[model samples]
Target: MNNAIGNSMYVVIAGAGHVGAHIAEALLEQGHSVAVIESDMKRFENIEAMDVLAIHGNAASPKNLADAGINSANMLVAVTGSDETNIIACVIGKSKGCKTIARLRSPDYLREGVGTGNLDVFGMDLVVSPDVVTANHISRSLLLPSLVESGELSEGQSLIIELRLSEGNPTLRRMLGSIQLPPGAIICSVSRNGQLLLPERVGPLELGDRIILVLDSRMLVANVETAFGVTKGGGTAVGGRLETGIDKIVIVGATKTGIQVAKKLENEKAMIVMDTNTERCQHARDVLEKAIVIHGDATDSALFIDEGLGDASVLVATTKNTDFNMLSCLLAKKRGVTRTMAIVDEPELKLLFEQIGVDMAVSPRMMTVDFILQNILGKQISSTQTTLHGSGITVLEVLVKDTLWMVGKEFGNIKFPRGAFVGSVIRGGKAIKPTRFDTIMPGDRIIMMAPQDSLHKVEKLFSYHSGTWRFR
Candidate 1:
């Protein structure tokens, strides 16, 4: 998990589009040697300009992959726009004894029992689906309007929320340890002026600083809002009071991303999907029986008025066209929609959308990069560890195997390394707040937080296996 020289890996990436290029840049920043293969000459030039080895050739071609050093690569990432090309390149990479990962766009590839083998058996160790990732993120953001970002751990029993400190907040100018945190809540990391700080030695919170908090339940979010003085009129923070629970949802576009979002929200709200393409509208209508699909351009202001956009609790712009998505969201905001979110393809456009009055702007390429990085680097550790970007910490979700070192021992008796702590423990799918008196048992998944350098020691502690079950 640590980016030590001994842990540096050789990674080959196929494709030079936004998703592929972003992944390559991230891997290089983490001290990994990276090579990218792209067919487009312009994209090849862009990758080459980044000071990495760039091969201008078809990624699925054996000669192109060989030129990228596939034989010596530790892993191959296929992320071309075409699903077939990605799958073909991964298959080739797998044959060369390299671990392969594919960026699959079609849900059919992920469908259970689809006649094709599982990802691993199909020559891919993992599959990253940006559409699904974007849809899930939108769903969570819709549910928690106050949270800047939300991620769940411990089988969705524990939650991580990111919120920004603004003026008039109660926690400002106070020592980290002095803040009255709710039960089972902790401030894990802080971001100040684009720099990360651990709570141990960090100074008093400052306005505009982003803080990440881990809690045992979503119920604690209200406490956080009250402590930080965040309200519906707060400045630059997504933390706000929703007038009502999500009841009406309006989705623009019937692209794959739009369709996926509609599918996720259709059951929870009264859904209306709008698209310019008649065929796509028909397809969405057929698939989403509960949703009302309209054949019209989402960017048209007339259409928004006709649909009564003001009544929508949540308006999502999922169209692939960035301009259309941004314009539609602006119109929705003008119409007094409670919340607006747009799926921006370009990272730079996010800031532009925010300045133009959009409530939230998400980048699919950025989200996909995070998903691939976590999965690829996580699989390297025999005991997986996910490196929380920008936070100098690594999180490991490990099962309490039947090892004498851990099983049947009280939490306080075990000697945990410095900078390592058990965040939460899941037993039988129920979250348990770890206490000194609690005894470890087999089949328990313990979520641990550790500094990067100490990850090896943390993993070594749970590496062994004694029998399957153990009683305390």
Candidate 2:
């Protein structure tokens, strides 16, 4: 089996739902062969239009798995809506000597040490949960308050933050090369007017340009906000006197995602969870100790006034209904909520919701795709995280090896491909801000950001093999 992902390999995906179809599309774009097995006729027809072999049958059936060529498949990903089907399909794939990835939603299967840790009971290489991934994304935004989107890298030792240049931002209009950022921070990419620009190619920062930054996780949030001219007060982005903690947060839905969000923030911030379903509300009440669970409609204007929701610093809509989530967020904004977030089922609608008024829109399917892609691409790379909202840029953590060509080269001498940038270097667990004169050393882990097309070149630069590589 090849250890580098730069080469193309055959991949089999089960269930051509949103998650599965998106993963197939991404793999095909990366020059890999793909086949999808979907049980539903409509979904099968939808995915059959793509450049893949589409089979209509139960993914859990061994016959269907055989038809999909699982014996020759390099990897098998099971992302059906049913957890049992996903697990069974993965077991079949694993028995065929194929790498297996399963997307299971039940918390029982997602415990900390079940499939990971010292146990390999699941016979799978990776497992992902859409609810947990989406919940974590929402919680990070609420905790940071100032960042537009945020994610952790290198085992939480580093952070990748996206922030828009507001009107009062100090870095606005400054040349990208001229700004004096914090000691361990670097601008990785900028999204201006719908164009993704590398920091070196970008000129002066403009208003509304979304910039992605890579920095040490220990750096103070306030310092990053100050560097960008964003003011936070009372744990909200609206300027005021600085407070010690987050303000009141209102979540509407009482869903698994909603309950997870409340649980994550219950100890750190005041939480209120509201839903029209009395059973779900009661369930949330039993599960959460600090959150206030209410059995009522969040869209009800009377409930907003009765619960004093206008004082909430943030409002999140996590229901399954897309229109309801958007409407609920708009109502929250009308009630004077400082910021509003919604869970968008359709990835394309994310930008549309943000443009209308929603502060942030997260897609669970997109999150799942990112998680799977990170695992699939982890054969050679140490770790990976992509920018939310489909910016086409990815952050990678790579270990420098003595067998690689650039082991003893200076940062200034190597000609890095276009759209690729080395952000920082970690030597002996300490982050070293990269300079033109710094020398690449063995065992050093380098943090880099690049687009999908340039990944092969980036991988070649750090690959252990001398001539060629394939990762699957």
Candidate 3:
């Protein structure tokens, strides 16, 4: 039995900022008792108003951990702004017999022979770097064709693709069940008019609805786009020409994310970086082998025009300020950059920025939560991935056991639980787009989506144990 299953854990979280606050709320919603410690009194008040047990104090202080009931807590997550404080808090939490996780931004702590795997010596069970997670997500998003935001689904073998509906597509304005998608394609989540939906039996998809699709192989993505006319440059229903793969990449901001993006793309494309801070720009120039560094404000139209932003194939805004990132993307789009991406820290801004024409909006806070949750909830069924914006829907992969009654049974023979359905199946290294007549064989790898609450039910349905294999 999993340690966290059935038992509601006492989870103590340090820091009430964007990442920490969101994690606490999610843990509470999952039936865990949560207490948050924030040094900033104003932030503490904000979190306290949300019904959480918010304490105002230094998390690194033993007295604060005691006040939060660390002695009785099952887990302690330190996501404070200062890495030193987070490390110290974990050390204290460990001494109290709590499982500890620390969230750090600097890579120094993760370097070899440094703070890497040796974290166990310091009482930290896991060290999560949001910067690395955000960087990887941004890199994957850049590789997506037609400007879609893509994430790893099924341990990087499958993908969660976010596509905006283009006009006059056959897949639009029809109930999901009515549409015939390509093999291995599943429409799992929909973001329509600012509402996030886990469509169990969803209605017709609307024009401009941002939909997320799970594909066994990303190669099938172009087929869906072609069938639906969805493209980054628009034109189908969005009313703009489709943008192609990027060649010239322009990044605004010299923060760690910007530097990481520049380094990732420098070898394959012509990279240019712009930042207001001269010292950071110089450091980025020195660190990146071939990237061109420009000392200028991203929000300044004059700077962009002088830099010929219009000629760039892709523009990425990585500044910490959400408003600045939006403005920079707008300027880039106005200057004829076909694709624009922004680094947005807040989840609420993701849809808003996309609505205003930003092609992609990556969030560090959301990335951090997905990592923390996956760690807290160990892999049992298979690998799980968060769809766009950390929507409650998750794509999972599991092996079908021969002992299960459903094995060798037609897909129609089983009734999937609410908010869940099989998306794809892999057998003998070949991917299959499952149909009602398709029979599930033992040892097949099946991909499915379900709400977090329904995951256990889904898992039970796929278990090989004769007791669990029976139809409910």
Better-scoring candidate (lDDT), 1 or 3: 3
Q: 1-472 in candidate 3: lDDT tens per residue?
A: 1123333667889999988887787666555688999999889988998756778999999998999988888788999999999999999998888888899777777763132233777688888777667776777766664536666654567666777665656577777676567877777557676555655545888876767776778787767766566544332443344444477888899988888888887897889999988899989978999999999987677777888767887889888888889998998888788778898877767767876788778777877876776666443245443444334455667666666667788988888888787766766654666778988887677777776677767766654243221100
Candidate with better TM-score, 1 vs 3? 3
Residue 242's lDDT within candidate 1 is 31
Q: What TM-score do all the candidates reach, one by one?
A: 0.69, 0.81, 0.74
Error of 3 at 378 (Å): 2.4
lDDT-superior candidate, 1 or 2: 2
- The pairs that clash in candidate 2 are 4-470, 4-471, 5-471
Superposed by TM-score, candidate 1 places the C-alpha of residue 429 at a distance from the truth, in angstroms, of 13
Clashes, model 3: 5
**On a 0 to 1 TM-score scale, where does candidate 1 land against the true structure?**
0.69
Candidate 2, position 203, lDDT? 87
| Residue pairs that clash (backbone atoms under 3 angstroms), model 3 | 166-237, 167-236, 167-237, 233-243, 235-240
Clashes of 2: 3
Candidate 3: worst 10 consecutive residues by lDDT?
463-472
Q: How much is the lDDT of residue 253 in candidate 3?
A: 92
The whole-model lDDT of each prediction reads 0.72, 0.77, 0.73
TM-score of 2: 0.81
